[model samples]
Target: MAELESPRVMSKLISFLSSLLQRVAESNDLNRRLQPQKISVFHGLTRPTISIENYLDRILKYANCSPSCFIVSYIYLDRFTQRQPALPINSFNVHRLLITSVMVAAKFMDDMYYNNAYYAKVGGISTAEMNFLEVDFLFGLGFHLNVTPTTFHTYCSYLQREMLMQPPTINSAESSLCMGKSSKLHLCFNDDESSHQQQQQQQLAV
Candidate 1:
């Protein structure tokens, strides 16, 4: 794995990821107003007061995982959404989703990481809930946790395009969070798929 990113780069990465997730959650929330979706264990009875940016920043500040873990976590999220189409990410569930995905990513990709109890405290949930979330998320994703080098590069390129399209501005009034036009994330992880096909899917509707 690559060395950890510098603080500045990591901060920028966090800001970019936070903005992207916030946009996804907000979009899903708007959609849910029209058609209610099935709620799962990931959903909270009420949305947490903490802003998405602050919550993600807190995770990065304390988790101490490699930068690659962030990318991997996002991959896990996309996979989960694909497998569980009824559970599109929304404001009520995104926070728990973020914490669980990051924790699982750290466990898979990092040599050393804090246990579930510590992550539970950081995420403002009980240790038992955190453990349950980890298991449910893995099953939701069918335990397909290994990210090949090609798949990793594909996601990195997609994020690079996103950063270029929308510069890393956290919450500027002038900034708009218009994501890519497609409604589906075209991340083809099948080994049989060609790189060119995956590159085309890099538009990344999410």
Candidate 2:
């Protein structure tokens, strides 16, 4: 935790995350192009001009959530892809996905965060689209917003290992070959506030 507070370590962390996501999105896009897939709500009519690295850096700049949110956002993205196999991350929708994941992660993990309007502006989308994406993403994850300490550590370890293997540059080509795409997250919601609070507290403790 102390090391993570250092500016240099934080920069490196962001670099590793952006690099990993960029590579994964590029690989998925290539695979998606080879076999055209059905368009989902996440897809845009045209791919955004911004690069994933720049988009992420912009989020880090404007969204003042803790650095840990980035890791949680990555987890959310992985879960989203696993659940919504038809809507894999690609250049066409990666920017929106990144913003949604980060914003959702901030809401789940942080004590305070920007509202949909602010996040929408930060994401280069409208408030209505941001709201729509939030609901869709939460529903897609089945509102399974909790992350256990073990799971968190596992992801952190994975990122650290990848960082060691690849250069600390967001433009690196090396990354996980493919994101897993087998199972679907159960898409059900229960109005259980106690359970939700417990999950949030557990994640906060971690």
Candidate 3:
């Protein structure tokens, strides 16, 4: 249990700080490469055709959730959609698929706990339907739920150390308490999925 929780609860918090700063410094330097020449079947996923962005943005705006979160949630939807090209498409069907994907991601990423009932209540569905969707999504992803990465973990770790390193006159402990509340708020921001195969390949290659 100690080994399991050690890295989960505490990772020398110092080491995580440097790695995070590095990622931040490098984030802007990274470029995307979906060569225009290549034919991606889902290239239809691009905006000029479906305008998925505007469609999702409208729904998420109603929910008071960021368009970015819905966008990332669609990334998860595509993880399954890309593999199976024939999934049915409908108004509420799209929302159910996308929302269920995000809930799975929230469960993995949020420091706070989430349950299917919470999704059902907000989604105005029975808990049984949420459960079925959850199961369907898992099976679709080959029983994978550990795929999403939480950017909050690094941000929280950095905030903790930043508060710690401040001059003593600032009341370091008090500063930490104040920052803790703010960090909790940012954790609500849905983070982007980094690499899908990285987690799977790393484990399997070992």
Q: Which candidate should be chosen as best, given lDDT against the real structure?
A: 1
What tens digits encode model 1's per-residue C-alpha lDDT throughout 1-206? 23227777667677888887787777677777666588888999999999998999999887777788898898888788778777878899999999999988888777667788888888999989998999999999998888778778877777776666764332321112222343243454554323221111111111
Better of 2 and 3 by lDDT: 2
Q: How close is candidate 2 to the true structure, as a TM-score?
A: 0.80
lDDT by residue for model 2 (1-206), tens: 33666678778888776776666667666777465566766789998888777888889989888888887888788777667777767777788888999989998888877788888888999989999999999998888788766567766776676667865332222222232232121212222233346213222210
TM-scores for every predicted model: 0.81, 0.80, 0.39
Q: Which ten residues in a row have the lowest lDDT in candidate 1?
A: 197-206
Can you give the lDDT of residue 101 in candidate 2? 91
| lDDT ranking, best first | 1, 2, 3
**Runs in model 2 with CA error above 4 Å?**
167-206
| Candidate 1: residue 119 lDDT (0-100) | 86
Better of 1 and 2 by TM-score: 1
Per-residue CA lDDT of candidate 3, range 1-206, in tens? Answer: 12213433333332332232223212211212211122222222322322333433333333333223332443455456444434422222444565576666655434443467766655545778888888877777564444344543444444455535652121211111122344421123244546443211111110
